[model samples]
Target: MAFDGIVVASLASELKHKLLNGRISKIAQPEADELLLTVKSTECQYRLSISADASLPLVYLTSKNKPSPMTAPNFCMLLRKHISGGRIVDIWQPGLERIIHFTIEHLDELGDLCRKDLIVEIMGKHSNIIFCNDQGKIIDSIKHVSAQMSSVREVLPGREYFIPDTMQKVDPLTVTSEEFAAHLTGKPMPLAKAIYTSFTGISPVTAEEICSLAGMDSSVPAQEYSADILLHLYTQFEIYLSAIKEDTFSPGIYFDGKEPKEFSALPLSHFVNYTRVEYDSVSEVLETYYSTRSLITRIRQKSVDLRHVVQTGLERNRKKYDLQLRQLKDTENREKFKVYGELINTYGYNLEEGAKTLECLNYYTNEMVSIPMDPLKTPQENSQRYFAKYNKQKRTFEALSVLCKETLDEITYLESIQTALDIALTEDDLAEIKEELTNSGYIRRKYTKKKVKIKNKPLHYISSDGYHMYVGKNNLQNEELTFHFAVGNDWWFHAKQAPGSHVIVKTHGDELPDRTFEEAARLAAYYSSMRGSDKVEIDYVEKKQVKKPNGGKPGFVVYYTNYSMVIDSDISNIEELE
Candidate 1:
């Protein structure tokens, strides 16, 4: 769900407090839809990120740096020339709408200080960054919208800056109980649909939350509610409105059967059985969701080729194995046929000359034996034919047995690599994985050079209880963390039946409590590619029991007598080290 207008207002307020009077030290366009502004206030330097991407428009503070275009775009150059040393005077939002305006004081041509407005609209498919002169005339914009783009209003150079008038929806902050009741009775919509449709800023998430607080069915017909039920619903809605007005909000994800059903400012109805986890602020929610999604996206893009390579190898090995298995089965059948024919040739003469079957007493052992042969063929001829087939099959079986074992081994190796690729966390880890695939011939090498040895880096996380947890992002890191960084008493975790990073909990030789185990499991689950799944089975064991299998793929290992738990792949609680 997108951030509510109230949340955006709160964010604008916070940013105003932090950024007002700050000098613009640097400006860069790190992406087509994003702008990074480095500001220096008297207290500290801050990096503020603003994005107008149609899918996810946001503004937040970040510590990360990104590469920019070598040659700046015309819009970027214009912004740099005019706003280089400007001071942020104020930050405001438009009537709880998805729009933020930053007024900056900058020196004009005559050295007179004047204010210019930088407007950012966060509305989906209509988001834009517009620069306006003191008179509110548009100078330029990241996107130039003409009459063709929007029939209601055109956003172009020299045009007067005006907010477009769209269809009006009820403002939740100003809605009265009578108005809400009238609207509900006028439409035969579901309770949640009524709330969402009638409100200007309320999301479906908030509507569902209101229904949950009222103990009413979100999917029930709005007009079907009794007077008492409607009154109760109105009271709860007022409480939610009051919370937003006071800026007292909680951020959490609501789950239905361990799957995230909604992320919202209030508790939701569909996930009433889910335990409510709390966060300190709405900013935390934004940061966690944005960063985690961004990280997963980056990792997936980086490992695409490596994953394809491993899959190809796996398929090839499987075909080879299947062929060899079929050959082995045929060989066994042929050998059995030969043994029967030899018995028949040795004893067939005691019966009629073209006999298909014979029963006779052995002279030496005084025992009976039965033999069968092809009725149209001589016994000697039948024996020769069977012997020839048996010899050929025996040789084929010997060859196939060796090849089958090799193919099976290759399949196991490729599968292990596939697992590692799935768990890769960072670009560096992906590079190492690709190198391994290339060395094994799963990936073709474009250039031959000496292997680059990079120092292993551990993934660091601080648990909810303040205990430190370290995870290995690659095989070398895994070895270092388990053997060098971890002590005997440290706890370890891995994903069951999945390729994943190794997670180690460093206790400093102190006994780990039960909460620590769950925290470690979350880390182990989150670090793997399966982090977004409803449940990830994690196996935890003492550090001493963990052993890397010989010739195993990177990050492959075996452990025994460990404890296991099915946990939600939620890292919302874990704090990653900077």
Candidate 2:
């Protein structure tokens, strides 16, 4: 996420090496604020994509091509007229600023050679792609700014194009140690904040990383550290900046589990326990990181409605389950009512007329018991009344016992669906879950002549012992994987008494190794509803021992004999197969 000055410098170096003296073969304005240039060099043909979007400004080399409009925009036409066959002379960054300057040499209308500069400013909402003459006079831009829009500088035709000195931050790439110490120690904020605020184009992420490299807590105040410690910090800062100076860029994306958390042109040693995937080039890093992030964001947006549906279903089922359990608790006194009927029959014959109470010896526990009576009713009638009440209570208990069990089963089924939704990574996964919901009557099924096809497959992984493991992504997949795909000798694993995926390991008739078992158990724990717990209980059994109940819900299975283990949910080391 920190596409700061260092990233810009890396990109500028890449572009200069690849497109230096390269001819601009094609010009495209795919989006209003974006440009895709086809540059032909002696080495290879490249597509350089640039975007000045207010929300997301990006510059990356891509192989993928986007469709341009039928008619080019005015700015596109202008660029095609002036610099269509221009050769890139230089590509550079302006002293650790989030900006890239490209100088192109081309022949004018009368064959006189001319040079123009294309500046891409990545300043968040103020980002712009300004085209200017060699004298720094603006010619045209992808987006124009007037005095009304910004009082600092205007990006219109014939206006001077310059970077605004808004924050007055010093260039970190060339700052001396004495100067660095003097400026950083004077700040009143935390150490990380002071570092970012004192330097140009250094994001808070980078500042924290710098502090981490110095082995200092970034949250401490800047002035609390002594001069010796400050000098050590400066040493670490120089070491970090040396990577950019030597052009030994190590580009990669850091992943927290499956999602990309951040990407950098240099090593981020402070991001402990995160997965760092190294790339050969910064363009590859940017393209991979942004595309993956976009897909994750798109999937989350699409799942909003589906999540609401599942959440609503879970809430309703949970409420019903609680109420049913309470009602079943009330039926616990049904046995006492039956005993009262017997005691009333035994002692009613000796009761005096107009008596309000009868004292008797209960045969059940051989203890003395007193039964209340209706004074106007005969002993026979009193006993009959007690018997009637016992029969009603018995029927109610019988009905509620079955109802409570059904409600509980429903709650468990809905919870499994909820867990499936949590791990849903693709539209097809959500579709399969929706189909399950429709079949289960939670959602109204729409009748059609042709059924929608579900193409989601179980997640596949290979254990360190070379065993193939498959994890279900939804309840239906769980049912398919456990009952149809797995054989008798294969092992099955699941979170103990929790809604989770059914993890099946293909044993090929051999007994699983202990390491493979633990790995499979970890997979079960990681995919379950209790995924983040320090320890999760897992149950494993042979496929033959795991049986689905007749007419049970999908993914519902029972096992009498199984092995249990407690393990953590760290699956970063587990090798996943596509």
Q: Specify the highest-TM-score model's number.
A: 2
Lowest lDDT sum, 10 consecutive residues, model 2, at 328-337
TM agreement with the true structure for every prediction: 0.70, 0.91
Question: Which digits, one per residue and each the tens of the lDDT, describe model 1 over residues 213-322?
Answer: 88889899888988778888989998877866776666675542223444566555466445455566556667766676678678888788787777877887898799
lDDT of 2 by residue, 366-421 (tens): 99988888999988788888778778877877997888788788878888888998
TM-score, cand. 2 vs. native: 0.91
lDDT of each: 0.77, 0.91
How many steric overlaps does candidate 1 have? 0
| Candidate 2 Cα errors over 4 Å, as ranges | 178-187, 329-398, 532-534
Poorly placed runs, candidate 1 (over 4 Å):
1-4, 19-50, 53-56, 61-91, 102-118, 131-140, 157-162, 165-168, 178-198, 204-235, 249-292, 321-375, 380-409, 444-451, 458-472, 475-578
> What residue pairs are clashing in model 2?
none
